[model samples]
Target: MVGLYAALELAPEDEIRLLNIPLKRQTEDIACELQVVKLRDNPKYIALSYTWGSPTSLNNEEGAEDISSKPSRLILCKAKSNSPAEPQPLWYRIMVTENLYTFLLKARDDESHALDFYWIDTICINQKDSEERTRQVNMMAAIYQSADIVHAWLGEEDKDTGMTFQLIRALASCCTGNERHKRIEGLKDITPKALGTRELTAKLGACADISNWKSMAMLFHRRYFTRAWTIQEITLAKKMLALCGSHTIDWEDIVKVSEFLTVTSWTRWISEVTGSHQANHAVPNILDANKTSGNILYSLIRSRRFMSGDPRDKVYALLGVAGDSVRGKSRLTPVYGKRSVAETYTLAAIQILEDSDDLLLLSCAEGDSFHTLPSLPSWVPDWSCSRALGLGVTGYRRYSAAATIPRTLEINESDRCLTVKGFRLDDIVSVGENKQDILSGKPFPNWLLIINAMPPIYYTGQSRFEVFWRTLITDTAGTPPCHPAPHSYRPAYVSWITSKLSACVNETAQQTGDSTFINALGALAATEIPGSPLSSNRPLSSHDNERPGDSKNSIDLDEYETTFSHARHLRLFLTSRRYLGVGSESLLEHDSIWIIPGSRVPLILREVNPSAFRVVGGAYVHGFMKGEALESNPLFRDITII
Candidate 1:
């Protein structure tokens, strides 16, 4: 016990603890032994990655409840004595989560003839000693990267999991290495104009059947995908296997499919022919090809969906995989007990703000949402909260409201307030129904009404119809946004407008002035027609709206619906300054928008008092996306955000 504790403090570059699980015997409790070996000696070992606590979703797989909610059980770890005088080995009963114990049992059985050593964080690190825990934590990137094999405990298989994995393999066929080469050959001949047929609707509908569709959602809904710490573990591993009971899935297979899904839609929509699986430009943000502020901020933005018990772990776990620029600028260490989560997050925020000349982190600060940490300031992103969407959508950073301008800020650490210089961009004069409300089959005429009541789009010389379409898609298309979204998307947008209007036609029973706007929108939706010249004279007929597949534009409408997934989480707004854009769903009627210098996108802010404001999150204002509002005599004021 004495030697084991001292060895941790003296841990060197090559030193690591690997549990040696003896061959399993039936009807016996799991037991293990430890060996502190030098990696330079090339001791082959497997690393296990898992969550020690309950799922944030609280919807654990049935019968795997013990894996998440079971109380910790002791595992006997017999270690070699420090001296020969003490001939017998000393025993330590280290507490292990049931999930860890389950892995030990399975690994012992599976590897009884295959291997002997395993590396797991819980028992390996002395959780009681903060310094030892932090030291080992800092070495996680190395440990995971060095492992012979990384096994992710995704929890025991549910009834649907086997089919889910089978479905994944099937859908992933087009993205397989062989198909990648074949797709590229076909891609050269398939122009963006011809890719509309690339919807792969019939093919997608086949593999993405109703059963498989629900299974796919359930697969992702599993707790394993949502852990923040696992981000680095998954990214750095040379090879990983996601295990659910006896079922095994190659990590590469999952990624190949995910990358395919993330790319194919927007890649085909754009001029780029990136059908190859090796194209890193279309890779996940954490595994991005380049090491820059883009890697750090972009991954952080995407991580809002992942969970961590310690808020600080949200930042610390990701740092292991962040670009060198981020790790170098923010020399952050995982000090578990010294600071409050708010203080730690603020420190991380300050470093991130200073790292990127622009306020890239600003895009992550979401609107008022559910947060466990009450002390967290409004300006700082509560990474634990899913929050809502923002301008940080993939490739959205290209919208440079303060293009190339370095960020400027003065943080009053005492109160956790951030003050910055910027001009008042606009004030929200009218805000339509939120995404949830509109998508819930509620009154969409309110949206039509709000737009009808809006003042002219005098700033950009764009029409109401033009701004309406552009704002919905944040005025950009593609995964990596392509500016002035292709004209091909117009018919799709009009098609979407018609479909939503048709669903709520029954709302006419409780008709108000909004009914007239609904009638007018049907006409407005006809502004664009597929395979025909753009004009508003052709009104959309009832047949086109009701029976979707019967219309020629149905394919384009489905394309718009699929691509418009991000906008479904946002609200469309018209400002007092005559600006139009999509903003946070938490937006209100009078929220103000500001263009802070060094910030890439416009910020939606709500005033709390004369001196302070609550951040309502970032926005995608049309016309002003490219620093359009910066006048020669631009007025800059130090606005304080809580």
Candidate 2:
């Protein structure tokens, strides 16, 4: 660390450094040689894809290098001495995290992996030199894509790893091999709803093992899947295989299983088994990620951070995979020290809006109005926080709130406000419980309270009670996940709600592996609210006698819960005009909903002053979703949101 080393300066713009592993090394000697390679020469090497774990804090008793992990071991790096005139090769002792050290040891002993040279970010990149870091980051995509093999280290295996890996192989096989599954897979929208009641139950059973659902859930519990950098690292890799201790699994199999779980909504059951909301959440993120083809918006949505302590990385980390982020094309150039996080986030929001040519990014700002960075404008999203967009905003569902009119959207970076032209749709008068209530079957009462306050008739004179079920699912249903609601959902909704009101959640959840429904509906039977409609006096619907084990009833609960779970952490709201909708958990009583032009769904905006405002988040209002509020000669105001 002293005069023994200078810097790992990658002198040439096109040249890079690699850690050279000697074929035979002294067991006691930890020194590894360094090799410089030119991209033109096309050398063979493997890169590492992993998450930088929690750092050791100042209060940590370990007293070790605290950047990525707690325990770090000394590694000798071959470097040049400080003297320029007579540069001598010196063995410099450096520290690598215990995790990385273990990975290196595994790589060394791995007879299957024969590449001698390796490219690891922490050792290969000059982190202390900001200029060099920027240069290297620009080449990260090319580095991963050009690598002969990219080995993803999923950290040392745990007790569940064996069972999870076995389940992963089985589920991955079922997705591709099972003939019964293949019939449903052949349909354009391969969802559980696409199958008949018998097929749905049979399909759930036909998988190699549904009993190992907990193990499958534990696989996603790995921190490696949540890091922002993992998206680009695994996405751009030419050939990738995940390594966990002694076991190695193809990355494609993991992707296939995750995507399969997503379409079928089987991932929701993981929450019941693992009792971890994180595992419940992670599988769908894999659904959002496409291996080789994805756009900037999709890349941004999938890049959830693992708190690397740098907010700017939430945007910078995904630049490599953002199709629009090519050098000259993207306004989002990855700058290190030049800009603040506020400036970076503002710049990124502007860049994405202009590049994406829509207001979709505005919908992604899901945190509470309390801006993490005080300087960050309300219109500018704090990418540091991870949040999912509204269900209506997903590619699977289509809703055009503004007709075919060209957008009059403008970004006023000088004042940090977005000027958009559209009419105010409604004001959120009452807000209900969010997705968290579903696990306890308690969301029903407060949501029912909000819906009950409104008139029985909808704006179009349709039954508000009927529309309530449609609004719960954003009015999209069918055999496919994204189809229009068939007449069946109405009766199905009756059966779904009555089943919850009549039955006991603890007993039913154990029988059906459905704690979420019990959580949502259990409150009605369990709690006695004074004016709650479904209190003791109200008779259970016609389906009360049908047990959850009944095939017909089980299929309906599966379909409804599966559909509702996809849109997580949303709160039901009643607008001032009696319109019902589900919005971001951040939605409040006084927040106004606006139908901004060129936006697929309406957005919640909190007024800061008279005309200026702050974007709350996206919403799925019942009546105005399909441009019903847009009149031919409707006046559009230029509202500015800071």
Candidate 3:
């Protein structure tokens, strides 16, 4: 950690670094200095957002300088000069990181770009001073928002950067309604010899060469998109420019291309033409910047993949770009060393729940059996960890359970408990271990082993297993109607399940033939037989007796196979009452399924002590998820969760 003991206090407003860009000199090297100035002064400046690469490797020596040996003070010069007759040089001592020093040198060298000042975090704030660092971090939203332009420096360019930016600009131009034909003409003019010799040009449909798409993908894959701080830097800037070495592209053009690629079937098209599934992986992060409203929880969840040196920055970095409602409710002021990581995250969860007045935040909690912070309640999500457990894949689905009863959920911080008014739905009685192969990205061959491992009750009749499987994949409530039915009356769950499964199977079969389809179906059927372990090669009666030419038999086989395939994404769990549901993979046997009043889904809670429990994860209990528990013998109790 960077530490500073000396304090240099400024006026009570947002103070930012004002870079004194050195005048052109005949010398090979020119030194640039930075000073602090209030943002209210309306300085014409550009804000830089870049990642601080990995730490410099230390030299091997008997006596090497360490953190303590480094200089404790930085010389800061004022941007403005005093009268020439009585010139008085003023300097203040502060600390600066090596990364900031390199950035300053680069900015000074780029004399073509005119700017009176610049605001960069490392140099602007006295990082050693906790109070100043906290104040500046809290005002980051305003600092970036007030800047004339935000310059996104993507580090030194590589050989392909020029071609990448050219393709990006050309694709962005194609998005303009009137410039489509013009852009097409421009692309046709520079068709690479490699593309011109092949049929790729014709296949691209007036867009840039297919090979260029690979270059564009490489550009987006830069570390710039993966940093948590850049999200707000690009989103909040009034006018932004992306700089890569000598090349530059407008931020608006990048946003336009992102929007265009997302709306068009760009990813599918790229895969079809170039046979590359990874072509558009970075497009989602670019689109995230355009999202201005809705739940901030989704943004926070999505940003977990991003890296930050300081763990607290995972939440602090996003407060600026988060919506007004979330920003107001969270009210997360950055307090550097005073609060522990557990306290920061715990407080964030409490505020979100209190503000939304719902249990949606609980849905984001994944089970942490070995809790990183023992002081933190189980219900609070450990944002520092990368494991995504609760709600599993279904958490991302856009559907909420019907609201039939009023819920009042409150947190008792002093008691370290969460008190909610709701009835216990069921207790988890059995849970199957998540397949290591599937989690490791390998195909799981035995779906039946998982099903057969469940209690016999799940395999009886139409099977509650089918209900659980149907709920996991399709958003039944969000499905469009088939005709005469009113908007409010959605299709029955069973009918919707059959239709969706048949559609998926038919589509897959159409793409790959009957041989692959039958093989997949046989594998699924082999799992349903009694006493058949996952490794058993014995073919079941269902697979052996199937008539390939029978349409009814094919549909039934497809439905079963499709359901099994979807269920592979979820872990099967049984309630103490023997009720079946799909839950987080980390769920354990004693965890309780709860239907809090405002929650759209049931949540899993694990007991910590006698009366207090912590959240294990969330669940998709088939029968009770849609407020059914509230309708049947509705009883409210003070449920204490810690």
Q: Tell me the lDDT of model 2 at 445.
A: 54
User: Distance (Å) between predicted and true CA of 259, model 2?
Assistant: 1.6
lDDT of candidate 1 over 414-479, digit per residue (tens) = 888888887777799887776656645586766776566654343566546667766777766643
Best candidate (score: TM-score): 2
Report the Cα lDDT for candidate 2: 0.65
Q: Write the per-residue lDDT of candidate 2 for residues 1-642, one digit (tens) a residue.
A: 533324555664777778765443766545666666787789888888875563112212211224455436877778523456866687777777777877777766656544568888877776666887888887888788878888888788766667677756755655544332242353233343433345534544433344455555666766666666777777788888888888888886777666566545565566666564444334433533445445666666655423344677777777778654545644577788888888888888887777766788777777463356778777666776654445633442377887666678877767777788878887889998776576556534566566557675677665555567678887876434444565455555655665655544556566778777556545533332211334456443432323223434224555666666667768899988888888888888999989888777888988888798888878888877778887545678998877
Candidate 2, RMSD to the unseen true structure? 7.1
lDDT of each: 0.64, 0.65, 0.55
Candidate 2 weakest lDDT stretch, 10 residues: 55-64
- Local accuracy of candidate 3 as per-residue lDDT tens digits, 206-298: 344555676665565555655667766777778888887668898766765554443233433433444433323433434344355445565
For model 3, what is the alpha-carbon lDDT of residue 156?
Answer: 69
When 1 and 3 are scored with TM-score, the better candidate is: 1
After TM-score superposition, what is the CA distance of residue 629 in candidate 3 from its true location, in Å? 4.3
Q: Which ten residues in a row have the lowest lDDT in candidate 3?
A: 478-487
